[model samples]
Target chain A: MTREQEAAVINAVLDGDVNAYEYLVKAYEKNVYNLALRMVGNSEDAYDMSQEAFIKAYNSLHSFRGDSKFSVWLYRIVSNVCLDYLRARNRKATVSLSVENDDGEDVELDIADEASSPQALLDRSLTRDAVRRGLQALPPDHREILLLREIQGLSYEEIADTLDLEVGTVKSRIFRARKKLCAFLIKDGNIPDYVSSSKLRGGDLS
Target chain B: MNMCEYYQELISRMLDDELNNQERKVLAEHLSVCEECAAVYSAFSMLSDTVANDLVEPPEELAEDIMAHIRRAEMRKRNQREQRAKRAASRQIRNIVAAAACVAVLVAAVGGVSVVRNLRRSNAVYESRKIESSSGTTAQGGLVDATVLAPTPVPTAAPAPSSAPVSQYTAPAAESNDNGGLGSIIRSWWGGDDGWFSSPAPTPVPTYSVPQITPPGYGSTVTPEPYAPQVAQSEAAPIVVIPDTPVVTETPVVTEAPVVAETPVVTETPVVTETPVVTETPVVTETPVVTETPVVTETPVVTEAPVVTETPVVTENPVVTETPVVTETPVVTETPVVTETPVVTETPVVTETPVEPQLSMAQPDTFSDAFIPENSFAPEGMAGTPGMDMSFSALPDFEEAPADFAAVSAVSYDFSEQDCTEFVNAIFGLEEETADDAQSVQTDAAAAEANSGAEQYLSYIDKLIATEQLVPVTLPEELLPDRTESLTFSHEGFKFSLDIRFYGEQMCVLGCDGQGQQLCFMSDMSAEEYDTFVKDCLLLNEVE
Candidate 1:
């Protein structure tokens, strides 16, 4: 948070304006959702876990210490609550995104209306399919850190803050998790020899 | 760092932009050379890309559900808080009242306890003191101890020294009398039967011709005593045994004795002098115990003693000033403790004494509206229950009374036993009781009419018949002198009429003369029912 915004929040919380907590909730909701979806390997669970984490944060906010940012504290609570829920339900059975790669099978369209743009819907549908297949192949833990970094757009420090870990640990986990996902996508042939020679600090990103 | 670990971390940091340019360059160069780190880094990147693009949105209602749940929680908490506040308000008052009641009980109990303790202590002290004083007066020390109960409980504790040394052991009654035959009886009765320490086996209460005040409920009036005297009550430190009721009357008093209480009703004879003191020396006759206590009669005192034990300090009697209140304590009047033997002595006497059952009211020669039985001689309490000599009191006001003393006497005459049983049967939905009493009334009427011609029918009684309806009647004083009128009714299509005429005298209520009336049942209702059906309905409405 900005210095001014952080102070305002702290003041509001101290003044007992609990509803002001929504500011913090909305800010961290995406990152928390990404982490939860990856850990639980499901969309429905991810959404529920994210909402529950924020609610819990709101309730036990008084127990929070300023040693860490609010996002990190929230991340810790969400990860633990979702992990426990998945563990209790035996997380092994939980599936990741359903983006399956079609080797030879014809895909059906969910959009049946004539007014619907068939090509646009098809593109979106194919994207989901490819992503799902790639995600499901990667283990939940790896898939989670990557998503937090990629989509939720959390920085190394922010990710560490959310996952309740050191910046070094976050870096290591993300690296290992990415390595696994890359291997799966390659085996599925989703990427066709794709080292496009992106800009590197001193050498090619390839 | 080894090339492998170095590449792993470098690739990881590069994925997050955490490394500096130099490190990123090294990681890129390492990844190009190392197949393992490159594979790991790419997999991580792809996974992150897919999950974020595809998965999270919840169904819509959950947010609303949470808000509703919160509102409900707040409402419940508010209700609970309000309830707590209400209870707290009432609790303060209840606690104060309960506390006051508790304290009052405690004080009264303490007062009573201290009083009894003082009395006992005083008795021992008085006896010992008397022994000290009379050491030279009487030569026989053995008789001295038994003979006297000297120093009374003076409010201060100093009198314990003056107490005489009487034998702590109870002495025989003969020893208590000390050669004076009636002295011990007077003392025993004076103390009113409590803590007779050295006085042994109470002087077999000699049957003094004491008037027995029937305490509230001993059936009848016991005999009044003659030649009883009020002895020197305040001074003589006397003890007395108060036998149960026929011996002493219980005055109604509040029962405020403590929980653990042995309330010995000390109905003492207080002196009329300036010092209204309760003396141990007194007459054992039936005198109204405790005086005209402005509060209540004496029983209230006895009852209050019990209440005192429950409350330690009280608002009603705070600073129990030992106010020399000769006034009786508020005693709860014991319910009519009806003694059987008293009933034997009393009821027979009243019955045999030839009570002037004569209401003695002279009938107006030409009775006016004022002479209506309901206004004047409506039988009060003798309900139509057979042979029960019902003493009439709580009777409802009646409009008219039947004529003749026999009719009045028959107020106790219950011929409706059959109909009553039938009503009872219908209530239980069963068959009725036998018509035996009803038959008797019918036969009794027939026999009475045959014995005397209608002109001379002064001893006849009205026979109530159920033709369509059954009406309970009350007879006036003048009408009780003769059978005046007969009314008809119908019930459930059954009909009956009463044929009535005067009988005799003094056998009925309010008079020595019983004006008897003859009764005959005319059994028929169909015609009677048809004739006045609407009027009957109107009467039904007016019956109440």
Candidate 2:
């Protein structure tokens, strides 16, 4: 949990106890995979990118600057790799960069209708896949804003810098993106009308 | 504004985990009632979950490859530097060995040549003298001596000419310039190579920087000015040629180098002397500057320190929390501790949630010296509670004390509203011993038509009250300490003094009454208490 403990584990993995890398893999695997999947919009590429992000992370371990926390640094690398892969693979496909430069503290919604209570984590396996499908179907601008704000976890300021825009512009686009997401979620019957704003912003931080 | 915009700023900030105290209170209170705002909060949070659901895992083989690249790079650079170092090291060793061998060869050649030259000179001198003696020739022998010595001096003069000018070559110049016998003897005395002429020499008459009053005649002897009179001989290196002047006359040139070498040593001796001098002078000077600096610093430190500290102490004690923001900057740094919270709480300024504890978690303001009352009722309570009717009760009641606690202060039988009430008229209506007993008690009916007046009876009571010091008259100023507190009273054709202690709500008064009756009374209850006896039981209201 501490930075020292994580660094020690990283060092152990680097020393060639190849399987020891799994502790790190298990710790950060899902978040990295989710970020990649969100950025690229396809599972196969997402899976490959996630795997590659880990391999690149392991190989460039010495270059780890430690200016950011280990999770943020790894997430940044993973996010960047996803963006680059998406950019390289699809030259013809238009991908408007949203607030993609934000820091890794983005908020993600599970569509409140999925849970009986807002605080409850979604337990259904296929539900996540459905949401992923829904996310991929949306435009890149909408998807990237959602990913940066929620998945990649970037702040508006950081996203503005990465995408080259003003913070107000980033905020507006995220607003439009969330509005579109809200429309889609409401159309899909994901959240009921009774659901309130407090439950949305007050998701169980504890 | 729409509910969204109404709570828009707070909703955004709260999502960021940034609510300061007052903002949190406002928001929390709002959240308690507004269902629509709560719904918006719920929806915003759901988007948070959907956005972060998929995490991309990295490939496992990355770390080893990067390390391999770095290690190879380091090794390559190290090998390149090491190879270059090895070549330079070998070249340097070879050059040192060759230089050492050349030095040895030169020493051998110089020694051998010098020995051969000395032998030839000795042999030539012997042969010339022998030939001159055999032929009895003197001028030719002198000519031979000059030729041999003149040519021989050339090699020695060319190489060591600078030092040679002192003795080796000085003899000839000194001899030729001898215009008088004294000059010739003086030249001889200073001429010929000796220890004084070894190495190069310091200038023969070394001039240095001094308070040069060119000894009046020396100014007329301006010929010495050609060499810049009194220019320190140290300015010229002793190993160089001295000017070819009569005063320095090349004979003493070699002495310059030895003198130059000793100059630094001689100057250093005086430095050692001045170190002792400096230590002595410093002690003499140190007391004034050292003591002066501290004394100057101390008075201000001692005087201003407390003043500065006192401001901080007062401000710290005052809790000028809000007022400080207004007057904060003007107040000198004495108690700037008041505003230190500004920097620390800036984070709360943004989110404003953590700021809630300040409102709910603050200490009782009663302890703060700066807290002023906001209510009329709270003459005692601080900040003023809302519901209490403090205005009517806020100020302490300063009503007159009772003449007698047991006796009713209301309407006495001064005039009859009716001759008698049904209860009073009926003899057996009241619960007493009987009407005859009451009549027996008022039996002083005709005793000399009540010998004295009612005023006389009242005067007796006044005397009794006055003796007790409860007559409400001011006590002698001498008997009371300055600022001592006492009750103020006026009563029943008689002034009343009651030193009542405030026990929370009830004012308890302990004093002697009109009959000099000592009693203690504690009451806040209304008049009905005396009748129902819920409270206000008097210990003494006696009559005979």
Candidate 3:
């Protein structure tokens, strides 16, 4: 829904036409459900988490300040509900993707160059299952931000607002998150680490 | 990796379409040369595409389930509201009933005169009625008089000293009858009669015997101790503890002698004294002559001796001579001393005259030194119109004049005659100007005080808002802030107004209706609850 339509529906629900909330639920359910699905890795729990998030949003609908898009605000609540569920289940992220060096800078992974063009390799090898496995394998923080950015198509600024992070932090974290997913994909043997053939040397460019 | 790190961050921004032209061009140029960064960019792009395509359909019943939960919640809330309204209605009914009961009692107390009379008869009856009527009246009119009268009649009737034991024996029997009468009166008033008028007529008969019988029984037994002391001392002691046994055993011997002997012994002494004194004193000449001789001789001798001796020897010569001599000597001596003191005082007056002349000699020198510069400078400036010459010559003296004037005023009031007149005129002019200036200053000060007072009040209101003691609200246009009234705000889609009243030190915000009566469902909430309610209203306004 457009922001104006979303605001109208929210106002109607708050104005005692409680059934007007169904318009919001229908508009954002697919993205919210998919975000929860990607976080929890199961459909039943995903459905339950989505419902809880919607109810919580409805209960606190008066607190919405309209500082951001309604979807961004809703996604924040969705992510918080799923995070609480993950925390309650004691499912700590298995892989720590963003490593800090002695200087407290994120240590990037060094991928070995292979002899194939990257676009052709990505087209042939980057399957949906591989991406899902890589996403599921990611730490919950990185997974959440990436899902907000990719699955929900939120901008970095919108992600920053939703997650209450600085825009610079959002950019760096998304980069680190993408690198970690790529490393995961490589480790899972789903794709080759191929560089484009026109390079003098791709590794020397950094 | 170090060089690629910055470009890689740009590449991530590029994927998100966040990079500006400069960074985009730089990242594009680097990616054209850098195979590793290019491969990473391609991987990120494919991952973004894949994740964006991976939308899952939610369960069909999800929205229905949410709506179901919400509906149930709304139903529960509606039920709670209904229950609260019912509770409020019942509370209002209870208040009305209580008010009606109060009115009934007031009507009965004021109009029921016979009820008051019936209540006065029994002592116990008076006490019970006092308890019932205590809330309505002072319980005083006939009831207090009856209680005072109840104990008196029995003691007065049986004044014969011998009846102490008899009255003590009858007192308890009379007490039981009083109790029975009181109980029946109370039962008639409370149970049978409708509590107002009908019970008064029958109640008086039974209650009448109580005051009469009980008081006399107690009175003759208790009061005769002081009246008939002989019987009381012997018999009343034992009667108090074991009243029946002691009174029965002791009554026969003690009762007859006290009654018979007590009367004549009381009357015989006065008769004996009166008859003997009258008959013998007039008939016996020897006794009269003997008594008269000593009285006559002693009166004259004692009276004449002291008067003649004391008057001549002590009073006349000593008082007259000593007072005259002593008073005259002091007067004569004090006259000389008073005369000599003026001579001594004249010497100091003569000495002070010289000091006055000397001070006069020194006064003119200081006045000339101080006033000459001012006198010289004022005329020279007026006399010389040339700017350079006046500024050069008179400025230093002009500065010195004010210094000299301040110093001289501090030091003395002495001034030359002409300067003094000019000085007085200048002071008069300054005083008038200062008076006008002071009035204007006071006006400004008053305005400033008012502004400061308003600021203090506003600051206090701000502090109250900060501490949540008072909730700042935007009153609707029709409502005045100074009046005790309510403002309507919507919460959860229901429009309601809370009456804002200040109760002494506290601000009480209660849910009220159109008539301004507090809703029974929202009565007497605590301070914290009021804060919560006000915050909820503010939040609802913000949401709207």
Candidate 4:
């Protein structure tokens, strides 16, 4: 939809036609869900984070300001919600390991099925899994940069706006992040160390 | 690995296609010569491919779930608002009853005080008359005549001695009438003549019962204590924290500007305006040095009058004065530091220039797929199929046998393994006009050779056989003495432009430069190989 149409829907929602918000939800749901999934690293948590972000966006609809694209603004809300969840989870992870599950409180990552059979692990695409693990291993700041570039396909300027950073910082940061991920992939054996040396001998490039 | 480290970053940027033509040229040469760096490049490409290929499908119910959650939240909000309204209504009713009871109590208290005061006045009059009548009939007759003699009203005359305090009432009328013996006796008794009359008006003793004056916002009617030295009147200035209704009792005071003025709020305005201006002046003055000097001086000149008006003004001026001086010196000292902020800002612009091409290169919609061009090469619509080409240990060969020409063999050279000193010197020495001249020469020879027609077929064969060695495209006029290495060839009518370089043991064409409208070829790619690579791998439209 055009920006004007989306803005009109937003206006309708704000004008007490609360159901008009459904159009906005429908328009961005897929991308928002994908962003949340990448950020939090799990389907269930991603769903929760997506819902939380939408609810937050709805609650603070008056503050949306409309200066930026709705998608960029919405993604920022999703990113923040995921960051909050991650922070809470990290905080919980640092605490005692007592069985606090019954309280339905925030808990450390369950690590559900992260470990697989050796065959399954081998069969898994080394690049895909390694890159995923590499992304997870990076600091949140760097990881977000990679996701916005590689996954979301945001330009340096767009990422800068989303992250509230200078564009130059974004470029150098992305370069650094890609380097780190390459290092991680190499260290984790997703990429073989001797690949370049082996290819040093003459062979057909075609 | 150490040799590969430098090229590692370049390889990552290459996979992202963030490199400009110049950097790409450097990397291409490095990769051809150094297999180790080429392998790193391949790994980086594979990592990009993985991220691009793994597309996660969002849950279908996502929109529905969001809408349901919003609806639930809205319902919950509506209920909470209704409850709040009900609570507010009940609380408001309670407040009304409480206020009504307070008014009733206040009225009763005022009425009781008025009744007591009236009773005391009547008693004082009766006692005075009895005392006068008992003294002498002649004196009483004189008092009656004197009452007629007074110009004041009869009621005022009766209550004069009865209600008013003796000290306050003794002034005008008592002095003028002092010639009358009765009046003189009264004055003498009031003014230290203790023998004649011992306390004439006992009712005036209830001075403590008079209501005290209290300012608004204070809780009680009692007069407040004097202002403390450290506590300025402005600090005691009342803030109207009340939201909906104004406090009726304090309405007259809070509404009056004079009341605020009395509390030094007027003085505070100049101080408040001056403080921010003084603190801001140094910063403003440093930036616009010419105009601001006068402004700073003028502010002090304007403040000088108010400063002389009161000691408070005097104290405030020094604060503003000292603040500007202290802040100004640091700001001046920080001018160099402030100057450094722009330098830091300029660094970003320098850095930003590099990103501009990356932006123009990585155009918006296609960039997501740009890094994963490998996905487009997926055999027979096998796009997004994970683990399809995870192996980067060896270069993959396409064997559908479609091309009539034999595979263009890889010319192994490490463009990455350049000596730092030699590489820097070579790059600096290669001017664009000189390179362009060489490229023109190279293209013309290839075009002439291909235009010769018989030699065209031979050149294609020459390109394949020439892969075994580092064949430098000889410049018609030696562009570089020892460093120049590249292959130029033509197939059909098109001439291939190449810049081949040999760094130590690594020998390969470094990069392709389309100096004019002409397209160039990588060192290892013959005409047919270039065609297949373009078709199968590179998106022609994406060539930035």
* Number of the top-ranking candidate, with lDDT as the measure: 3
Strongest candidate by TM-score = 3
Score chain A of model 1 by TM-score against the reference chain A.
0.65
Candidates sorted on TM-score, descending: 3, 1, 4, 2
Candidate 4 chain B: 10-residue stretch with minimal lDDT: B386-395
Candidate 4 ranges beyond 4 A from true positions: A90-113, A116-119, A192-206, B1-38, B86-544
By lDDT, highest first, what's the ranking?
3, 4, 1, 2
Better of 3 and 4 by lDDT: 3
* Residue A79 displacement (Å), model 4: 2.7
Q: What share of the true interface contacts does each candidate keep?
A: 0.32, 0.38, 0.69, 0.63
Structural similarity to truth (TM-score) of each candidate: 0.37, 0.28, 0.40, 0.34
DockQ of 1: 0.21
lDDT of each residue in B1-544, candidate 4, tens digit only: 2446556666766666667899889888988998667766665566566665566777878778888888888899999999999999989988987886576557645644543442232122111100010000011111010000001101101111111111111101111011111111111111111011111111111111100111221101111111112111111111110110011111121111112112222111121122212223334334432112211111111111111222132233333333323223223222222222211111111111111111111110011111111111111001100000000000001111112101011011112122211221133233345334434544654677634221332332233225422232321111111122212222232222122222233332321111111111124444444334333321211110
Clashes of each: 140, 90, 4, 13
Q: What are the iRMS values of all candidates?
A: 6.0, 7.3, 3.4, 4.7
Model 1 stretches with alpha carbons more than 4 Å out: A1-18, A90-128, A151-167, A196-206, B1-9, B27-63, B70-97, B110-544
Candidate achieving higher DockQ, 3 or 4: 3
Please write out the lDDT profile of model 3 over residues B70-105, one tens digit for every residue. 889988988999999999999999999889767755
TM-score computed on alpha carbons, candidate 1: 0.37
lDDT of 4 at B119: 28
